[model samples]
Target chain A: MQYKDYYKILGVERGAGQDDIKKAYRRLARKYHPDVSKEPDAEEHFKEVGEAYEVLKDPEKRAAYDQLGSQWQTGEQFRPPPDWNAGYEYSGGFSGDDAAAYSDFFESLFGFAGRAKTGSTGAGFHAQGQDTHARILIDLEDAYRGATRSISLRHPQLDATGHVALRERQLNVNIPKGVYAGQHIRLKGQGESGMGDGQAGDLYLEIGFNPHSIYRVDGKDVYIDLPVTPWEAALGEQVTVPTPVGKVNMKIPPGSTQGKQMRLKGKGIPAKVAGDFYVVLQIAVPPADTDTARKAYETLKQAAGFNPRQHLEKQS
Target chain B: MKNHDSAPTLNGEVLEDYCLSLQQLCHGATAEPEFILQLVEYEVLVPQGGQEAEWRFRAEDLARLRRAQRLTRDFELDLSALALVMQLLDELMELRGSG
Candidate 1:
């Protein structure tokens, strides 16, 4: 596994004080907070920043981490020396589920709480695992109809000598239909395993939608802008529109102008209370480049009854 | 083609079908029950029970409570100010959605 530099991740020098480390962490946290940040990879960046903060925040963890020396470069292949954690003692309250997010390097040194407790052979020792949380990004179409997804989670395993081994377990999850963004799905008994007789904690996956170029969501409603020619807007025409479910024919009424909204009932997100899908009309005027087109435009101009700029003239 | 045996497939329940009660919400958010009750009183999380013991919160409320925890703990925001910020943020998101 590759060596991870906690100091480098936090953008702080080795000689920096605890206050400086905290200052740097807060700046990064605010920039990458999933709720507020507009960045494309905000969630990933948030998780990584959080991991760095978790290690650097505690004084004991910092001291232990610093003893590893500054010889190793980031991403260098590294293995911890046997008995590396000799003198210092860790009263590990960090449940295995808490350490599930950190990289293998962190797990190797500090040990996974989940694994440590689970592997305990001591009589009458029992501890419940901490619950874990993660965000899952899916396409909007997946919300309309259920889809299957595979995700790899980092976890710690116990070896014979009670050493922690970083393990990546992949699970195929079946996402149910009609789950909108911001809603969470609960997976019972899928999180960190309980120690002794304790019950395993649950896992919660928050849903987020991948950005779609054509459609946008509000609550359960879906919105899209449909382009129509000038003639089609003036004289009604039957048009085929695309929705998450499928394509359907929509009849545009006569004199349907630009900015007109047509609501398709029960076509938004499929939920208990289905939301309507809105089509916002945008008129596209063809350019008069050829002789036939120019003549057609001239004929329309001659036949026009009133000027469109009359409202502007009235305002002036 | 080989038959894929022993491949694990898991199905998760949606938030509407099964949600967290007051005690579970407290455990999940890592907040005390008193604070959650205060939030409920403030209408930050409008739960579906007449009493604290019977209150059940949806996933959306849980998400809001989590955010509220961070704002109040880290940023030191009062409940009233937090409510205003929440409203403004919701409006901002709605405006962005319209565009």
Candidate 2:
């Protein structure tokens, strides 16, 4: 067995406080949870993180691990000394279900089979199979108008010869309208095969949008930065703006301030539930290059005595 | 097996140039020749089979293989994880370029 550094795995220091350890574990657990995280190896990494937290969260287990000392490096061949855990009294009795879930190495050090005094009955006859989870990235436009995509997936198939073979299969999935990022869509009877006569579990597909070039998504609302000339912002004008659906004429209110947001009802991504589109005004100052343009800017700068920093001077 | 010593120097003008033979690449990667050959068998790596044993490798491909090897050996990341990382990185880069 290799020496595993539980503290390093959790990104916490060896002498960290109990509260800090608990906080870090909760944050990481939520991040790497199979349902939420997009990081690769989330499942395996999440398992390792959970196992590390399970041992570190308890003072008794932590003390036993610390006894191993700093001399043993990570991944080093390790075997616990005989009677190493001679005196520590464990407050909470060991649970076999947790032990079975953990690695054999962890089990050898602190395993307690038939220790649960409750004598809890195992999963009864109708045990639903564990749900399989996957995240699918879709185009932003697809959310506005629902789309059906044929996706290809590759899985390892165990043949009759016991050798693993690679197989490719296609699945047609219905992308619901108005599905936001981090939201999940459940596909019935598409998960891992069930044991015995049990029914198969569901496949949860978490939806994520491919970042858009012109738009940004914030929860249910969509925000777009629209650049307008200084004159257009000062004196209102009706201009065409592009949305996911199509281009529409939008009016800029007179004396519109820069960064002022305007809402267009039901113009954003049209999921089963619709969201509103927001346009943020950005006033662009024209750079004078030609002589006439320079003179025009000079006249405007002289006539329009708009001191942008008047408020700052007043405060001073 | 064409010796690495006998291989001519490439001027590096081309977008991608095959610098070393398949054997040299395997040895350089500290991987088995057969394991590298599996990529060729899968058409992941295109190699001309004959007495000359002509093998072509793009700079991008060489870099990807190096990264793949690092994920496997250094990080102990499994193959599925490596594939997912590659896909995610590609999508991220593509999104950035488009933006």
lDDT of each: 0.78, 0.65
Q: For candidate 1, what is the DockQ-based docking class? A: acceptable
**After superposition, candidate 1 runs with Cα above 4 Å error:** A51-60, A81-86, A89-97, A111-122, A125-132, A155-167, A305-316, B1-5, B17-19, B27-31, B69-88
> In candidate 1 chain B, where is summed lDDT lowest over 10 consecutive residues?
B1-10
User: Which residue runs of candidate 2 sit more than 4 Å off their true CA positions?
Assistant: A1-127, A152-169, B1-99
Against the native complex, each candidate's DockQ, computed on alpha carbons, is: 0.44, 0.01
Write model 1 residue lDDT over A1-316, tens digit each, in one string.
7887888988999888989989988888778877677888987777677677677787777787888899999899989887677776666535323455566777777755435654676768777765656678888998899888777677666667776766776767888888888888888987777778978877778888999989988878898899999989989999999999899899999999789999999999898888889998999989999999999988998997658788899886
Instruction: Write down the TM-score of every candidate.
Output: 0.81, 0.49
Interface RMSD of each: 4.8, 22.8
- Candidate 2 chain A, run of 10 with poorest lDDT: A112-121
Predicted model with the maximum DockQ: 1
